[model samples]
Target: MSLRFAEEIILLALDDQSGKLRPLPDRALELAVAGGLLMELAFANRIDTDQKQLTILDRSPTGDTVLDSVLQTLPEGDTSTIRQAISRVAADAPDFKDKILKSLVEKGILNREEHRFFFVLKERRYPMVDDREEKEVISRIRDVVIDGAIPDPKDVVLICLMNACDLSSAVFSDDELEQHSDRINQVARMDFIGQALAKAIAEIQEAILETISYMGM
Candidate 1:
């Protein structure tokens, strides 16, 4: 069972016991999902990106619904500036998190439960049906970020997406994230597409924070 990049990230983001995400602002999770999609395209060689721009290398279907849908949505032109592409994709995918979670649930990797708060507000919780898959994801990330092992290109992409979303502490303990921060950052910078996506995530995060601050003020 080969999980897509987004699926792997979602697995790591969920708590093993509770299946809830670690405390993170909603925008962070949104950006993480967007980043996951971009990384998946990079892994499939469907896209290539540099500091300046993202180029569509292969617009053909990946045969995976989500990836192919995104490929189809790309502009007819071969390239868009990195920020332009990120903004377009992120804007186009307002329900990215929900879509990814739903896919995982359908695959039987996660179980979804609905609940109500005070019998008024409804919410959903996703618990892992099979934790072994999540453990494998953790081991792969640990090998690259903590063990100082050379990572597969896909692992490198995953680490970059995790860091961009501020998910290192969520995936590992606070102490462990701190201990491995340098190595994690080092690995994340190894790919040009990762670098571009990380920067785009940072910019989006900054914009979200600024909006929140202004609203509070």
Candidate 2:
């Protein structure tokens, strides 16, 4: 089976040489993973969303365990806006992130390692055993953003998610990103779901920043 968007985000966040996750701002990776899950559901036709609300179109399992579990829990209604759905999923992000990581390990795409800090603290890091999937994801994005190739909706969503999570630097150098920034923004706006996800991520990030500023005062 293909890797889900959440799985892909985790893979992209891994440092190739260190076999450790890159340092990201608070809640960046988690919210991206959460948005990824919801994005996957949207593409699976199990759910749909518009500017005002997210609706559950079908509750039937996608046969993907993690997604099925999430889908099953989404209350049947268009009551929640897309942002609300993201917040709900992101609340359990650390747990769901683990689930996606383990799934990648089971697929033999990554190897999990443990290190003991001072023989008391345990740190788990994943090193890639196979990078084929990661390469494919990067390639598709580059093609669309750099070569001006028509983007698949999934690729467009990937672009938006990476930018939303501030993971763009992980995928491109500052120069390349600057040069192609327009294309990146263009592709990112192609999908309504991607647009909503980015907007929601921005609002949440802003709220956190505001809270931190208030606390500092």
Candidate 3:
């Protein structure tokens, strides 16, 4: 089965033992999933990006429902500023965590469990059913980040997605991230699509934070 880029990212964020994203922030996970969809479009050659803008290259159906839906809805034009496109897509996206989590459960990669506290408060947990997929993801990240090996384009994109989501601590300790910070950044910069996606993630995060701050005030 070919995993979508978003699926790969969702798997990477999950804990191999528990299948929960314990260390990653909820907000970051949301943005990362949304950004992953855009990255997938870029990978499919449906979109291209420079530092300042994102251009829709071909609006043809990617044969993937989720991706094709997004592509079909994109503004019909040559290009839009990167920030504009990012914000528009993100704002229009459905709840990413819920969507991706459901898909993972359906794939049998994770098992969904429901719990009730005192027979009232309900909670859900997704535990790993098969860990082989996640192991592959970790191996790829390890080869690039820890071994200092050159990353392939896909690996570079994954690294950038992980970093944008602040998920390094989930895979590596603070000490390791600090030691290899420069190297990680260097590898992440190898792909222009990843760079553009990272920028989008940052901008969306900032916008969310600002909104929260304003609401609090």
Candidate 4:
């Protein structure tokens, strides 16, 4: 079984050989991952959202540690809008990225190794233990953007994450991005459950950036 959402976001943001996160606009990755987390929770039927707010549908555990941890923290009642939920989760989840990496390692998708950059700076690296999953993800995106197949809703969500994190360049070449830019934009805005999850994500991403700017991230 695949771990969706944030795990895929981390997978995209990570350095394939080093396991370190790539330099992005600081906090953008976390914010995007938070949006992914909320979407996954919504899909799991543990939460639901509208243009206005997100509400808990079930409090039962999802049996995944990272998901459960964030689920535990979402405020009760319907006061939290999707953007608010995204911001809160992003703010609270300082370790969810590490947890996602550990989950991938446990799944044998990656191998954890210790290395030093300067003979003094020790760091943990996660090289590929299984490259197939990575390839499958890339293939799905290509199928939508390049082949013009109608995207799976999950693929649309992944594209939304990539946009939120400024990660299109990580996966697509300059020419491909240029040529398929319109299709990518169209797919990322696809609808979910009669609401636009892509719009929700894009709105949340902007809200996060505004907060980050005001707070000096």
For every candidate, C-alpha RMSD to the true structure in Å: 2.1, 1.5, 2.4, 3.1
Which stretches of candidate 4 lie above 4 Å from their native place?
Answer: 116-121, 192-217
lDDT, candidate 4, 125-212, per-residue tens: 8887787887788888888899998888888888877865688877899999999999887776674522444455566667657997
Error of 1 at 82 (Å): 1.5
Which residue pairs in model 4 clash with each other?
none
Candidate 3 yields a Cα-based lDDT of 0.79
Q: For candidate 1, lDDT tens digit of each residue in 86-141? A: 76667756566678889889888999988888887576889889778788888999
**Candidate 4 lDDT for residue 55:** 80
- A best-first ranking of the candidates according to their lDDT comes to 2, 1, 3, 4
The lDDT leader among the candidates is 2
Error of 2 at 134 (Å): 1.1
Which is superior by lDDT, 3 or 4? 3
Candidate 2: global Cα-lDDT?
0.87
After superposing candidate 3 on the true structure, give the runs of residues whose Cα lies further than 4 Å from its correct spot. 16-18, 23-26, 92-96, 116-121
Q: For all candidates, what are the clash counts?
A: 0, 0, 0, 0
User: Model 3, 79-193: lDDT tens per residue?
Assistant: 9877677666666554555677788888888888878888874767788888787778878888899997878788888889888888877677889899999888988888887
Give the Cα RMSD of candidate 1: 2.1
For model 4, give the 10-residue run with minimal summed lDDT. Answer: 191-200
